[model samples]
Target: MVAVGYTLMCEQAGPKQLVDYAVRAEDAGFGLAVVSDHYYPWLESQGHSPYAWSLLGAVAQATSRIDLMTMVTCPTRRYHPAVVAQKAATMGLLSDGRFTLGLGSGENLNEHVVGAWPHVQERHEMLEEALQIIRPLLDGETLTYSGDHFEVPEAYLWDRPERPVPIALAASGPSSVDLAGEYADALINTEPDPHVIDLFDSAGGAGKPRYGQVAICYGPDEEQCRKIAHEQFRWFGLGWKVNADLPGPESFDSASSFVREEDVADSIPCGPDLEAHVAAFKRFVDAGFTHVAVVQVGDETQPRFLDWARDEFLPRLRQL
Candidate 1:
């Protein structure tokens, strides 16, 4: 059967506060936690970006039996795969081996900070290279790698967990999905596009786990939430240049062509009645996403969602 999880903002909620919520979610029967990994706050208004790996450690200590995953982490840039491998190994050991490393091609918005910019095509190659480099190192031995994108000399992981950690790549495109099926343990495609399932299976991911996530605002009113979700969260749907990594001079053109300032405004579903919130999730379920994540995006009514998730959402979802 398919499963359910949530995407959390560590910077917004703080590690302990977020972990405390996940503990309650686990108790209430949620299956996993997909924490965001960001170096800088995506929006100036949101105002936070705690180091994700440290937060994952707290999450591991807080919940037993519930999977703790980065909704996705970008290893090709800001951090080297070798270091990510080391940290993931430690997190796995700390969590008693319940961790799954989520990978992605990454956004220019985040990865470019490290000075290596990636075009979509290059990012595809980077993801492949990153996985190749990181997986072997996670084997708990001294490793050596020299690739087109990265190099490591006799770099070995110390304190790795006894078992090999699973790797899941978050991807939506055909080539990237195929790469995951060919190399990774699972898939996380956050957009509620069920057609992505066919794309994945076409690439040999038929039996592998697939995950999706969506944003929602829950309250008595629907229009109010849409306004909040759209304006505050609009940064997400902006075009390739602004999001995908592109080389110098070209990225500005790509970002400018496909995305406009209004599109960057928040427009995700928020502050709606329990019925509408369930309806929003149903789209993912109908689209064939086996694991769906509901991310709480704003600060104004985030707490009321605890009551909404427990009293309103979970109980109602069980019947469906």
Candidate 2:
């Protein structure tokens, strides 16, 4: 059976609310919770972005059983790979071995805050170099390294989980899929694309876990749900190519201004209809995702959504 997970949505909620929701999600019986690591919300209207690592520490202390992940963090810019490795190790110890570090090449929206963002190919190269430093340290190694894009004069992780934290790599293309297969313990993606899964397996991730995410807006009223999804998440409708290159929330706001409610409603499973939500998730399962995270779009709708998930959606989704 595919494991169902919840999105922590750091971009939409403050640290306290994230911790509270994580506790509720565990109570709601979600087996996993993926939190985004962003310096800025995709749009200003989304209204928040607390440091993800700090929020995760609180999440670790607050929840007992649910697995926690970064969703995806970029170690190439703004953070050194050594720091990310240290953070991941500390998180693993704090969460009692339930933390998974998810890494990606990153987007300009966040990375650009420090300096000019590198091109897509160079970004991937930087990520590969970072993994070289991160993977060994998580395995409890002390190292001094020099690479094309990064340098670690000397670094070591003194505190680490008995078992190395599992690493999941986010991939949406051939290059990234190859990287995930060669280095990651698991795979992560936003789409239900079987072709990517096949590529990942053939490239060296055959037995690794595959995680997928699907956005949904669940509410008593369909129209309200549609409105909420479009208003907060229309930036997604612009697609990753555009989404990754944009410099800020204002850029996203302008780029996605053309997105209509119907467009978001068409793609995301909207409203309280059980079957619609089920079918949306089934696509990822059908495409062979081992874990499918339900990204609930609106922050205000979380309490109601969590209640409904515990009472209804999860049980039905498990059957698929």
Estimate the Cα RMSD of every predicted model relative to the unseen true structure: 3.7, 0.7
Q: Against the hidden true structure, what lDDT does model 2 obtain? A: 0.94
Which candidate comes out best when scored by lDDT? 2
Off by over 4 Å in 2: none
Whole-model Cα lDDT of every candidate shown, in order: 0.74, 0.94
Q: Positional deviation of 139 in candidate 1, in angstroms?
A: 4.2
**TM-score for all predictions?**
0.87, 0.99
lDDT of 1: 0.74
How much is the lDDT of residue 160 in candidate 1? 83
Deviation in Å, model 2, residue 220 alpha carbon: 0.6
Kindly list the per-residue Cα lDDT of model 2 for residues 58-82, writing each as its tens digit: 9999988999999989999989999
TM-score top scorer: 2
